[model samples]
Structure formats: C-alpha cells, structure tokens
Target chain A: MKLIKIFSFLLVLILFSNCHREDFLQHNRESVKSITGTWKIINAVRNGTDLTDRFDFSRFKITFSDSSYIVDNSVPFIVTQNGTYHLDDPQYPFKIYFETPDNFTKELDFKYPTTNGVRNIVLTFSPGCSSNSYTYTFQKIN
Target chain B: MRKSLNYIKRKISWQLTIVCAITALVIAACSITIDSIDQSDSINGGETMQSTLHVTISTNAEEDNSRLMVAVLVPKVWNARNNASISFTSSITDGTQKMTAVPVGTAAPQGNGLDWPTLINNKIGHGGNLLPGWEWAAFYSDNAYNVGGNINLSVTVNIKIKTSQDNISFKLGYVVAESVDGLSNSQYYNSAFPGCFRVFGTGDLIDFCNPQLSTVDPLNSLDNDIVTLNFDGGIIDNALANQSNIFLCAKGITTDGDTLNLCRQDSTTQLISQGIKKWSIDIWPRGFFNLPADKQLASIQYYFTDATGNVKVGSTGDGSTPFTYTFKCQ
Candidate 1:
C-alpha cells in the first residue's frame, strides 16, 4: 500500500511539471517579440550638453504597438505626427523611423541599452541642423 | 640636468614645459609653447582672413619621426574644413611645408580611440565662445621628418579661412600637437586663443563673445525643435523690468506664408525667472503655435511682455524690431 501511494504522487508531479513546460513553450512560440508599450522620456540632450534637468520633458510620451505609433506632447522629435513605425532591423536595430499618415518617414539613429536592470531606447537625431544633434532616452511606463 | 622655461601664453593648452639637458640639446621629453599669435580682431565677411601662430617645440629624440598635427576651432558657418587652408614653416625644415586635412575618422594616437577634433575639443575648451556651434578642423603635415634627436625648433603656422557671409563674433582657438603624442596629456600638445574675432556681414549679429538682451539657446533650429528663448532684464532697461511675471508674444511665420499668432500672457507663455533679472522659457514651436502636422515655420518674431501683455520689449527694447529666430541648417 505504501509503495502504491508513493508511485501515484510521483506520477502526478511528473504530469504537472510536463504540462507547465508545454504551456511555456507554446506561449513563447505563438507570441512575437515587440517594443509595444507606453514609453516616457527620462533623459534628453542637445549636442553634448545634458538638458535632462535643465529643460522640462515630463509631459512627453510615446506609445508603440505592432505597426502603429502615437505621440503625446510632441517635442522636437523624429516626427511631429505619427501613424506607423519600423526598425531598420527589428532584431538588432540600428535605426528607427516614424512614418506619418502620408508616408513621410523620418529616420533616427537608434540605440537600445540595458541599465540598472531596466531596458531603454535611445534615439538621436538633428531636428534642425545636422551640426546640432539631440538624443532622447525613453523607458517603458510599466 | 633639466631646465623649465616660461613663455607667452594665450591659453592653458599652450603652456610649454621645457626640460632640457645641460650641455647639449637633448630633450628627455620635448615640450611645446606658443611664443606669439598674430590674428586680426575683425575680418569682413566674403573675404579670406589670414593669421599666423608662432610655436616652439623641443624634440623628444632625433629618431622621433612623426607628422606634425594642427587644428583650428571655428564656427560651422565658415565651413573651415573645406574653406580653410593650413600650412607651417619651421626652423628644422625648408621654406613652406604642406599640411593636409586629417581624414574624418582617423583616430588620434594615444587618444584612447578619440579622433583629433574630439580629443582637442575635450582637452581644450571653446575659447570663451558662448554659442553652441564650433568646429575643430585638424590637419597633418604631408611628410614625416626626423629632423634630429637633439634639437629645439620654432614653428610658424599660417591659417587662411574664407569667412561666410554672416555677421558673427567668435573667439578663435587653435591647437598644435604631433602624431605621436596626439593630445594624450597637456604636455603632448599646445593650444592658444587669438582672442575675439568678428566678421562684419549681413543679418543680425551672431555674437558669441558678448551677452545679449534677448537670445535663443540654439540660434539654429526649426519649428519642429524645442527652443529656449532667454531675456536678460538686467542687460537692458526694458518696460517689463518692474513686473515679476514676463510673458512671450510670438508670431511664427510658416513656410507657406501663413502667420500663427501665439501671443498670450497665460501660464503656457510665462517665463521662468532665473533670478538676477534673467528670464527664460522653453517652448516647442509646433505645440506652442498649435500648428497642423504639415505646416512648417520660416521664422519666429517674438517679444517679452508684462502681466497684462501691455508692456512689450523686443530686440530694441522698445518694440521697434522684434527678436527674430530664423530656421536654418548647414
């Protein structure tokens, strides 16, 4: 009787562990990796000067989902109006683009770095002159 | 035995630390100094300006064969990399020596992977110029010369730049270093500032040397940019000086000849006081003017106002001509 009871417990544990692994694998295979989230600016720089504390960038936020993007409180950004977006290489992106409704696209130098256990998106572009470059760093508003 | 000598200095990077052997011209480590700098205080736009810098270099070794490097910091509008010419003459070499532009990405030796311009600008400051845009154009001697191991030499570098047709006041700076040291430390290079220079031309004066009553943080930007407008109530006696609250009244003229009025005395257009009678406000042109996505700006003409928006102050402090910011790129 004791041997039968031990054998039944092991069988149930094996079934539960196997079912959990299968569910995890199935979820991973079905979902595509994306940068779909509401992101807010945490830092800003003009040329080489840090303007994070000097200027007010608290109201700016960007939301990216699949192929669509929306901007709130637009600053000097890649595009004033956004309709769609894309990465130069989604897996290892070096550039990102904001595509307006009319298909007018603006490309910006893109950088993704993990810091302090948090991932960030850094975009650099010159809104006015190429001599004056601006960098904006964004973090997911989770 | 070693001897350290003092020479005329126009900047900190130009300070030469000369250590010499007692009996002969043997340099344990050769140092550099700028004895004198000759440049004009004023140059007219659309013309070529010529300047000469006299430098002294102590040779590290007779076998130290390296190209001499020189760089100049100038406004981007001049496009010094394309329009400027740099050459030098030395006691150890023949009449005129040729120098060519150091290619864009050539890393400076001993610079820890920094390029010549970046290394120089980081080590040497902006020569007291206040404006944001400055370009450092570096050059290298066409040929390498091992003049001698035991030698002290004097060099004169001639610089000629074709001034752009914009009225500008800039504090000119220069740096001299060899290919080997590459501005690794202060001992490796010498830098100098000739002083404030001005080019008399058209448009409003883009003065980098002096303060202004009303100035923009970035003198160049488009309607899509976040621009900071600054007003110095202390610099001039304006009508709104007594009021604690200052506002911005601006008219943004679009590229399509449409004028957008953004003048209001509410919270949005209020300038933050930075004390000492200084006031500034950062505004996004697109959002400030409430423009449609397709519209673009040509220029913005603005003025400072009081609480009721009655008292106004412009470039002339009395609203004669509005302070204007024109969109431009180079």
Candidate 2:
C-alpha cells in the first residue's frame, strides 16, 4: 500500500509538470498613420467633371519625404516649385501646408479617404481660373 | 454559340415589344408635344430677346390644380431669372395666361423631391452646349387650372428675355411640361432646341455656336498647369490645314510685362497629330518659356505654323489673328 501511494503521487507530479503553459491575451496597439512615400494621381476632376479620361494625368507624381517634397510631372498643384509640406494635424488632418523654397506658403484643403481598401489623399485647388477647380486623388506607390 | 445567340435575340425582341407597349400606354396617359419654337438667330446686347413655343398636350388622366410649366436653357451670364418674362395662351383658356418665375426651391410634382429648376436641369441637360456656365430657368403659370380628362389642348407660349451686353453665341432650348407630371416621364414633357443664338455686345466673341481652328481646353490656365492648345484643321480651311506637320509659335507675357518668345519650328514646338487634321500640344508654360523660378506668366499668345516656318495659323482660322490665353484664377 505504501509503495502504491508513492507511485500515484509520482504520476500526478509528472503529469502536472509535463502540462502545457497557458498564454495570457495581449492587446495589439494601433499603428501611427502616415502620408509619406511616393504618390501618383489615381483620379482627377475639373469643375465637377471627371477628367480622368479626358486628360493624361498618368505621369503626375508627388513624393513626400518628411518635411521636403518634390513634383515629377507638374499639374495644377498647390505649389508649383519644389517645396516643404506638412499636415495641419497629424492625428486629424484637415488641411496641408505647402511652402516653396522662397518661403511662399500655400494652404490647401485636403481630405484623406480610403477607397477600395486603399488610402487616398485628395487635394482640391484652382490652378488656372477660380471658376475651374480641380481635385486630384493620390494613392501611394511605394 | 449560334443557337444560344439566336435564342437571346428572340427573348430580347419580346422584351423590347413589351417595353414599347408600356411606354406607349404611359405616353397616351399624359403627354406634351412641342410642335415648334421660334427664336431669333441673333439679337443686340442690352435688348430683349423674344421667342415663342408651340405645344400640344393630350391627356387621358385627370389632373387637378395643375399649372403649365415652361423652362429655358440660357447662358448663366444672361441672368435670365430676373430678366425674363413669359405668357401663354391655351385652347382651353379664354384669354392670355400669365406665368411667374417658379419661386426658387418650389418642388416639382413627381420629381422625387427635387425643385422645378433642378428637376428640369437633371432631366433636360445642357441642350448640347459644349462649354460650361449655363443654367435652366423654369416658370409656372400664375394660376392653376383643373385639367379635364380625355382632353387635348394646344398652347402658345411667348417668352421675352432682356439681354446683357456681352457679345456671345449660345444654343437656345425650350421645354414644355405641366406641374402635375413634371419631367418624371419622357412622354410627360417635350423639348425644342432651336439652335444657336447670338448676343452681339462687346468684348471678344464668346462663340459657342461654331467650331474654331485654335481653342484652349480648361478655357483657363496658369503657368504651373499643363495647357492643351488644340488646332482643329478639319473644320475649316487654313494655311496649315493641309500641312501634316504643325508647330507652335508662342509668346509668354510675364507678370512684369516681359515677353518670352518661342517661335522655333523644331521638334520641341511640334504638335502631336491626333490624326484627321487635328493637332494639339500640351505645354507647361513655365517650362516651355524657360521661365525662371521668380518669374510668373500673365498670359500666352500663340499661333500654329507649318514646317520651314512659312505657313502659320492663328485665331482667325485663316492665320490673320493670333489667339491669346489669359492666366487667371477667376
């Protein structure tokens, strides 16, 4: 009887020691939103008319890197020259500021909307005449 | 595949027949037919432009407290809302009936919650005007009458629009419908596009009626924007119309009254042929003129030329005049 009790206790101890460990659930924190990297024109409009097919905006690109920016094929953009750009608010951006090398800053209203599960940065500006307003939607390429 | 295609065609025929029969029924219920429209080809600015609309309405359904509706498509610059008046004489009415501007925001019956002007605009469209800046002006009879069932009535609408002194050419359109049916059904309304009208006032001709040899897209542009200068040689005979190779000769006027001329007949200024005598060049004013970073352009005056710089074309389709495009934000 003594031997049997000793064997039972050893089996229980071995079973408990060999059992797998339970993992505690961990929460995944949200990532910081960004507008960096190269963006190309995904869609464009003029005076409420879709100009995507009417005009060739395929080569237009605006690359954003930290504070400074550059333009590839210039369309009627906010700033014509190579300039610095920043969001009004990083967390809840409503506007963007583009400052030229000469310190000429042009404030532009922008909307960041996700289209078809992809983020798009929309900018509206009147390059030629005030009556002709153009909205350009950009999507990140790299 | 052939058997399947034949079966599809048979099914489509039956469906089309049914759709046509239903359309006929709807049209027979309440329909307006515009018989004619009489508008002047041209009128002097600051004067009143008169027009007339002849229509017939046949209805098998009774509508109570319904008013006659008339709408006009005109240039926004005309400000036709406050400058126009209308009166109608119908076969059923004893005397001439007065019409007042449909108060802004007055909802049209059966228009799915849209106002009379909005509904008319959405339904009628711009009457084939190519450029922007046009609107529809809608008016309603001052008094509503109980239109009897199974009755056919004829109406003659007289319209007068006081003009603004802007030398412009535009297409004129007229529509006739009743307040009861609105523009809900194509059969419920009728329209007449009487063709282009002209207001000879002052300033450069805003020709919307005919085609031009040299035209600019976006009608407005800035140095930073890519402006397309279109040369349509097919429409009219010009010096460079028969030439296959056309080049651009342009002069950019700076903000400070400096001119940058690029009149070379090289590949840099050559226009891309879109086949069929249509040539176009998309140019960035800043780059094309080699404009410095500090300098800005106020406008550009340009003309089309052929190889060897001998043949040239300008605003005057015959190459006598140069076309000027102003860079403006307004």
Candidate 3:
C-alpha cells in the first residue's frame, strides 16, 4: 500500500509541472500578440528637451507585421530601414531586441499603456553617451 | 524447499534491475527532447536574425587634392574567429573598359611602411590577426585620358571571407568619383627621402642608382660635405603644363649672420616615371661645418613654386609654405 501511495504522488507531481510549463508558454504567445501593430511617433523628447519642432516626428513610422519590423523616416530625407526584432518576455518590462540591416544589434525597453481608451507604446533610448536620453511616445495607428 | 526460495529471490532481483534500466532510459530521452525544444524556441524567439557577412564603403575627401577616397570598413563581430581571412579585389569601370585600381597607402603620421598594396594580392588577415573596425582603401587615378569628360567611375569590389567553419562572399559597388577632371595636380616628397634630408659619407658623390638614404644622419662627414636633395613631383602633370615654369629653391642662413643660397634648379628633364618629374639639388654645407662644434643646423628651408609664384608643392604647411629639416653637424 505504501508503494502504491508513492507512485500516485509522483504521477500527480509530473502532471502539475507539465501543466505549469504549458501555461507559461501560452502566456508568452498571448503577450506577443498584444504588441504587434503599426505605431506612429506622436511625441519625442531628447535630453529633457522637447524636439518636435526641431525634427519632423510625424514623418517617422514603425510598422510591425508578425515577427519583422521596418522603420520609415521622411523628415529630412526619405529612408527606409528593415530589421528583425524579438521580445525577451511577454509580460511587464518588455525588452525588445533589434538587429539592424547594418549589422548593429541593440535592445530597447517598451511600455504599453492605455490612456482614454487608446493604447500607446513608449520607447526610451540611452545611447551610452553622456546623460542624453531620447524618449519616443508612439500611438497605435493601425 | 531452500533451493526454490533462493531461485525466487534471484528472479526478483533480475526483474528489479531491468525495471531500473528502462526507467533511466526514459528519463534520458525526455531530457534530450526538452533541450531540443528549448533550443527551437530560442531561435524562433521574437528577435531579428542577421546574416554572417556585412560590408560597407565610406568616402573621405583628400586634404591635399580634389580627389575623393573610398574606404572599405568591416564590422567588429563579422570575422571573430581563428584562421580567418578576407580577400578584397577592386576595379574601376568607366562604361567602356575595366582597369585595376592602385591601392593607396595611408597618409603620414601613420608610417608609410604600412601600405596595403603588397598585401592586396593575398588574404588580408592570413598569418596575422584582424581586429574589428579595420579599414583598407584604394584611390582612382585619372590615368586613362581617353575615357575623360565628366564621366562616372564605378568601383566594384568583391570581398571573400574564409574561416575554418565557413566561407562567405560579398559583392559591393560604390560610385567613388563623378565628373572627375582628367588633369591631375598634386605633389609629394619622394618616399625615398622621407623627411627631406639624405646623408652620405665624405667625398661620396650623389648615387642616382641608389637614391634611398642609408642613414638619416652621417656621423663621418668632415668640414665640407655635399648632400643631395631629391624631390619627386607626385601626380603633377608637368608635361601638359609649361616645364620651364616649375622650379625649386633652397635657402639657408649661415652661423656668421650671412644668408647662404645653397642650390636652385629649374630643369625638368629628370623623368622618374610617366608624367612624374624629379628635381635634385646638391648642397655643400660650408656654413654648417664652419660652426664651432655640435651646433645644430637651423633655418634651412626649401620650396617649389610655379611661374606665378603660387607654391605648387613643398614639405610643410599646406604644401605652400617652405619645408624645413634640421640636424646637428657631426
């Protein structure tokens, strides 16, 4: 009887662990779906200074379709850049890794906030130079 | 009865051993499957994957001339492995015929001995280590006068990277120069006389056969010594321009407060190569040797000027100002 009880306990533990792994994977997949879309830069701040008038922020558009992304900038000149991006986690504090066409790999954190029934994406870039930081607030257009 | 009981115990032990073996095998198979699944997930993980090879071309304006220079730059992580090498083959096409490009060496302060013309024939990093962010350059000379007049020059380069694990090839094209004027106007001191001073033994005539100075300073020169000042006109097309208009002048101040004119030559007959002219002057340092002892030679200046007095070439100060070289008299 004692041997039968031990076998039963081990079987239950294995099933519970398998279910937990599946739950974690499903959570990650669902998180990735929420962050995929076309986002337009509505506001930009650099080094505690606003640079909307100095730069044409409205001309910048980042489109995300499935796993790949492309950035189109037409302010001073029309330039299109394509790259691949990945999410480190599907939950809060989302870290997005980008690999540029020029062979540069970088990571940026993204925040998803909903204000007044509108979803917004915010990205900050601190380029390891001085105390300068660039914050880009994007609105989901599509 | 005792023998049967012993046989039954042995059978039970065998069954237990077989069960344990099967369980261990199942556990090992499960671990391998889990690891494979993790690897697959990581690859498909929402991230951008990149190709192994990347190449780019950047241009910089030459300070002395109007010609533009193109440099090939490679990323730091592209070739991070042992026994790795890269081969670059570049050519210039002018819509008619293709010609091989002459690999230009880096400018002064970085030592002229580090030129890449000799290394361009083989793999760049063979038998040596190639660090990240290294650059190699080539320049377009207007040698072909037939394909002249505001023509577009295309520099097509083929790069091959070989490693122990894999080999990759990249073909890159760049428009190095457009509307290039066929007339070349530039000059530099001959590489043989690096710093504009050549020393020789006492009573030794200027050896044209071996122009390269054996030493920067001749410790054996007596009171009266003759030294040759050799200058090569670099890329300057003196054939098209007036030959008599090009001349070089050297001036020195004696230790006795008197100005001494060493040597001046206006002859353009010495042809180093096609379109390249040579000017040489032999100077006897009477004032330099007249110094008591161990006094340094000062205020020795030389310059090349055109008929219009516009400094065409010199060793110092934007090639317009006079170039000076000083050394202690032995």
Candidate 4:
C-alpha cells in the first residue's frame, strides 16, 4: 500500500509539470495574433531627425493578415505591393523578414507591445557602406 | 504464498523491460522518417523557398544582321537541386503585329564573365539554331541551368524584321522644365508652355512639343536658354534614386573607330516633395555651342550609375538598325 501511494504521488507531479510546459508554448503562439490587423504610420524618424513632414506618412499603411502583408504608399505615386512576412520570435525585439514581388528582401528589427496595441518598427538600409536607419511608429487601427 | 509473490514480481519486471524497448524503437523510426522528409523538401523548391529570374536583351552590333543576344539568369537557390533546367519563351510586338524571336544557336553557359560566344560556348556547349538575325519564333530548351552564384545561363537569338514597325516602348518618366524661379511649377512643361523650344539665327523663337527635336542655332546667344530634365520618382524605384548618379554625356565617334568625349554635365540632385523625388538638370546652350563645328554630337547619352559602379547608358534618339544615332545640327 505504501509503495502504491508513492507511485501515485509521482504520477500527479509528472502530469502537472507537463501541463506547465504546454502552457508556455501555447502563450508563445498566441502572442503573434496581436500583430495581425490594419496598422497606419503615425510617426516616422530617421537617425535623430523627424521625417514625418518630409515624407507623406499619412498615406502609408500596412495591413497584415496571417503570414501575408500589403503595403500601400500614395506619396510615391500610389504604390501598392503585397508580400510575405515572417517574425523570428513572437516576443520583444522581434526580427522581421520581408520579401517583395521585385525580388527585394529586407530584414527589419522591431520593438513591439510598447503600450499594448502599438508597434515600433526599425528598418536599417545600408546600400554600399553607408547605413541609414528608419524608425516607424505604427498604431493598430483594426 | 512467498514463492508465488516472487514469481509475480519477476514476471511484471520482464514485461516492463519489453515495453520500454518497443517504445524506443518506435521513436527512432519516427525520427528517421521525419529527417528524410525535410531533406527532400529542401532539394525541391519548397513553400519556404524564394527565387527570381532576370532576363536581358541586347543587340549584337558586331554582326551584320539584326541579332539580339538574350540572357536568362536564375538565382542560386533555384539551381540547388540536381538536373534543374529552365525553359524560356518570348515574343516581340511591333504595334499591330507580333513576331517570335528564333534562336540562332546556343552558346555554352557563361560563368562569371560577360564575354560572349567563345568563352561561353567552350564551357557549357550550346544546342540551338545557328542562323543569324532575329527569328520569327525562338525557344531555349531545358538545358540551361545556373552553375553557381555569380555564373548565369545566356542564349542568343536573331530578331526577324518582317516590316518597318516601331516596337512598343514605355517611358517611365520624363524631364520637365522648372519655372524661371527656383520653385517648381507643374505647368512649365505642360501643353500650355511646351517644355521644349528652339532659337533661330533670325532672333525668332518657336516652342516645339517634342523635346528631342528642340534645336538651337550656334549663333543665338541672347536668351538664357534653359532646359530642365524632370525625373518622376514615382515611376522609378525609390531605392535606386537614393544610390544612383544621374548625368548626361555627349559622345562622338571618330573615323578612326575611337570614341570622343565632347562634354559631360554635372551630376543632378533630386528634389523631394509630396512623396516624389523630382530630379531636374538645367542645360545652358551657350556652353554646348562651344564645341568645334567639325566635331558632331553623335549622341546625347543619359547615364545612370548605381552604387555598385554598374552603369546603364540610354539615348533620346531614333532606334536604328546599327543602333547608332546622329545628333543633326540645323
């Protein structure tokens, strides 16, 4: 009887530990859902200078649905493109990989969940040797 | 009773050991199958794989007939699989009628060098038609494949000209004149002002709608005579604008088969406004007229140099058979 009681206690402990591990994995997957929706660019800055007035930030919008995204920018003659995007991690300091139709690929670093529904995306483009960084602030609309 | 208990315990222990061994065997088999599937996916272009194809067509000026050299390049990722081949088909349309270009011959795949025929044909060995000039129908068999990252597969075709027809071309953007002041005026190059104008020797002026034919006599030096080249950023890639240098160079060929550099304008900077980067260059004819009358302006070449030092030369003139344009002086 004593041996059976000890085995029963260990079985319960093992099952509980397994459930805890599964919960952690489930949370990681659910985090990606926060980024799915319509986002509009509210502020844009490059380096230490504000570029919102220089660029038409109001016309720029990005819509994310599942693993695909569409970027619409009217400032540069009503340009529209759809591409595939992926997030390396579902947590903070997310790394994003974007592939466009013209075979242009870019990797951007993102800081998200700033205030619960806002995301701060930072894109660094270095053509040749000079590095130019652009930081865009996006607010979730839908 | 003690003997029976011992027998039962021994039997249960043997059963447990067998069950553990079977479970381990099942897991090992599952792992090997999963690994095999992943390897197969990588060899084939799986859902996660991405690739691009680039095609370029150029005229073979050395050949007497109108021959077009077509080059097809595939990304390195596409060639990772064994026995990978690409089949290509193209058609050229000249207004009302369309004709297919036929392959003259297949030159071997050129590796890294841009040189034609000799080097490429010796390396890969080509299989196609050997006729010169453009063909009514062209086809490249599935023998072309990317050897490596830098190397590309190229094939040459002859374009057959049935009738004198103008090939459809698209003008992504155009150069426009800015107002007399520094401020930009959309109306300066519109129908009202007509962006192009000519100055005659009699001190008379005429505005022409066609900018290419805008002429000026060498003697007219009274007017300011300014022409602006407007570049629409919307039509071009913004990334290219940020890293490219736009300039105009006047090239002339001597009878000795030498190229003469007559004059080159300074690099132009683009103005960013309303999401478009408008690049304009002002040309003062006074400086252009200083060239000796014997030296004719063969062509006005618009050159674009990218960040990687790759230069693309284009001209604003008629497309002739030999691909040579003469800047006629009035």
Counted clashes in each candidate structure:
4, 3, 2, 13
Clashing pairs in 3: A86-B46, A86-B47
Compare the candidates by DockQ and give the number of the best one.
Answer: 1
TM-score of 1: 0.76
DockQ of each: 0.46, 0.32, 0.01, 0.01
Question: Largest TM-score belongs to which candidate?
Answer: 1
* Model 2: DockQ vs. true structure: 0.32
Ranked by TM-score from best down, the candidates are 1, 2, 4, 3
* Candidate 3 global CA lDDT score: 0.40
For B1-330, candidate 3 gives per-residue lDDT tens digits of: 999999999999999999999876443221000001001111111122121112122222222232322222222112312112222222233342222333345431222344432232132231121211222333333333322322232333232222111111112111222113211111110011011111222222222222321111121222233333445454344221344445555566544555555333334211122233544443334332344334434445666555444444554323556555442321
**Residues B6-102, candidate 2, lDDT per residue (tens digit)?**
9999999999999999987764588899998877789898899999888898888777899998989887667788889999999989898999888
* Candidate 2 local distance difference test against the native: 0.82
Better of 2 and 3 by DockQ: 2
What DockQ does candidate 3 have relative to the true complex?
0.01
Error in Å for residue A63 of model 1:
2.9
**Clash pairs (backbone) in predicted model 1:** B13-B191, B61-B149, B62-B148, B62-B149
Candidate 4 DockQ category? incorrect
